[model samples]
Target: MNDIRVSDATQGAAKSAGRKRLLQWLHQIVFVGPATFFFILIVLIPFFLGVYYSFTDWNGISRNINFIGIENYTHILTKDPDFRNAFWFTVRFTVVGILLTNLLGFVLAYVLTKPIRTRNMMRTIFFMPNMIGGLLLGFIWQFIFIRGFAAVGEATGIGLFNLPWLGDRATSFWGIVIVFVWQTAGYLMVIYISSLNNIPKDVLESAEIDGATRMQVIRHIILPLIMPAVTICLFLAISWAFKMFDLNLALTAGGPFKATESVALDIYNEAFTNNRLGLGTAKAVIFFIIVAIITTIQVRATKSREVEM
Candidate 1:
């Protein structure tokens, strides 16, 4: 009789445990199911469809698409001077934009973290540009470069603002860079602020007690502690600079002989302007591969430098 009771108890406990596991799984599904479903529907489906269309010769309005294996890729690599120029231009812009944005962001973050009378107001002023949409900001800056700068130059007799800011290749390139850095630096500053705030006060105090100067403390202690923020900032800045399009469109429109055309803009032009969906998709695929590889390498490199708290 005791053996029978023991067997019944064990069975009951196993049933209860199974029910608990089932409930937990249902709870997870209830929370995570909708997001997973939407992501697969929106992002994954479109991506795979784009991949399929990249190998075909499909115009935007075509009902028939013939598969042309690797032709588009070959043409882009060997024969397309515009694409080559755009790629090189994008690379240069990205390098300069990333460095300037990160440096400015870090500097702003460092300064604002100090106890100042108008720190909050200053942060708000700095971050206001980021809140504006890129397209709108581009248009605003366009006017400023054209009319506002001209007015200032006339009044002050300064040659700096009077130059043809967007009409020349050199000025157009640097004009976009200046706008990009100004717009993006503030956003990265917020990330740095959060990271800086999280650093332990005791660690900083200890460094100071050990006779570390302001520069030494920042170089050795503060930087290492906030490296995770650096990783995030680098990733964000790289993505922004590499994929810049709206600002390029509204500001320069690849003008001054297409000197400032980005790969994103090139892809847009190839598809919509030229009505070559297949070629555009091919360019997009190539762009994706390059960006993925570069960002992955950057993330891994930065993560390797992250010091444990």
Candidate 2:
């Protein structure tokens, strides 16, 4: 009996060791080995290269580089007013875009989730704008703003249709905003619709039984429940607004006189157009830091209010 017990114990130990060895081999084959190699090749290598280049006085074309330390960063922050204005402009656009896009998207989602004949068709149409390339969308809208709208204005003397949408500073800013909101609101509406669908029918029915108005039910029940989607939409809206370049470029081209220059456009011009590679990269790195900070704060703040429902 003692021999039998000893043999069973030995077999159990060996089986456990065999299983661990198989798992270790599987992990190496599946995750640790390829992922580590890919990260070093794709991410780590380029990141270090960018860090090295940001401190140098090398034009992107040259092989030789002179390390100038923080000079690039200093010039970008203090001496570059264009960069400053572009950053501020992006911030303003982002704040307003976040609020309007999410609010409008939520409303659209709420309205469309009810019984309707062409519900799927409407969703596809709404989502179509997002499928279009950003640059192409901007160019299409540019033509509309410049030629189509201008033609309408000339045809009709009414001030509503005749205003110079992209010719003036104030109007141009709003023109860009309008294009952004129109292109983006529909995409966000789909996200809100998914969240809205998850709300329990019983909960809504109880609220209705208590004689809660539609507005009250939405304000009290639906909005609080869909806070997760709100977080996602708000983050996306801010990032899109801040990084808006192609649209600004194709639509207004930062004209009639640099009035619509955004941070991304300014950096692009500085880096590629002006050959100020170091300064542009410095601006880019700083811009990245600012975005990271803003997204972190926004996500954290919104996450605090999110309910399990």
Candidate 3:
């Protein structure tokens, strides 16, 4: 009798849980139908179309497309100098942007969380640039680089005020990095702030009681505890850096030659400007694969480091 009662109770509970899950999923499907549908239409459909077109010679303006298997990929890899330049430039940008933004963000987050009077205000000011639209922000910075800098140089004796921030290759590269770091650091800071807040006071106190110095505490306790945050910020920075287009377009316009054109800008130029939609689609597909591979590697590396905290 006891065994039968226990079995009956377990079965009833399992059935109840299964029904609850089904009902919850059904509710979500009903409520999120519009968003899911729109995402499928807008994002998924275009993505699939782009993938399909990678293997076909679809000129943006034409209806007739030849089924050219691997020509687009071959052209981009073997024949296209422009694609190579853009790919390398994007690689450089991604590396630099990831390092600077994440480091500066971590520093700012650490400092702001300390007992400071104007820390909140400082966080707001730092984060202000991110709220602005990318295109508008790019144009605005372009103005500063072109008009404002020259005017300031004329008034002030500082040569940096007059130097061509966007004209040269090295300066142009750093110019993009500076702009990106300034805009992105605050967002990362916010993430770090949340991570810091979640670290229990007791843990910090324990570190202090153990005679650990500030740097020691940060290096030993805080960093390991916030590995998850580091992982998230690093991933965000890498992806954002790789996909940077609006700023590159508006600020440098890949100027002083095609020196600053990222892969995204290169793809845009190939597809719309030069009417090589198939090649552009190939680049996009390749770009997607690269991002996926990098993200997977990063996530695995970081997941191993994420502690119980």
Best by TM-score: 1
- For model 1, the superposed segments whose C-alpha errors exceed 4 Å read none
Worst 10 residues of 3 by lDDT: 247-256
Which candidate, 1 or 2, would have the higher TM-score against the true structure?
Answer: 1
User: Where does model 2 exceed 4 Å of error?
Assistant: 1-18, 24-28, 31-40
- The sequence of per-residue lDDT tens digits that candidate 2 reaches over residues 53-99 is 78988778887788999999998878988888888788877888778
TM-score, structure 3 vs. true: 0.90
Q: Taking the candidates one at a time, how many backbone clashes does each contain? A: 0, 0, 0
Q: Tens digits of per-residue lDDT for model 3 on 1-309?
A: 999999999999999999999999999999998899999999999999999999998888898988899988998889989888988998988898999898899899989999999999999998899898778889998888889989999998789988889999988888888888888999999999999989999999998998999999989999999999999998999889989998888889887699999999999998999898988899999999999999899999998999987
Backbone clashes in model 1, listed as residue pairs? none
Evaluated at residue 288, the lDDT of candidate 1 is 96
Task: Residues 17-92, candidate 1: write the lDDT tens digits.
Answer: 9999999999889999988999999999999988988998899898999999999899888999989899999999
Error of 1 at 260 (Å): 0.5
By summed lDDT, which 10 consecutive residues of candidate 1 come out lowest?
48-57
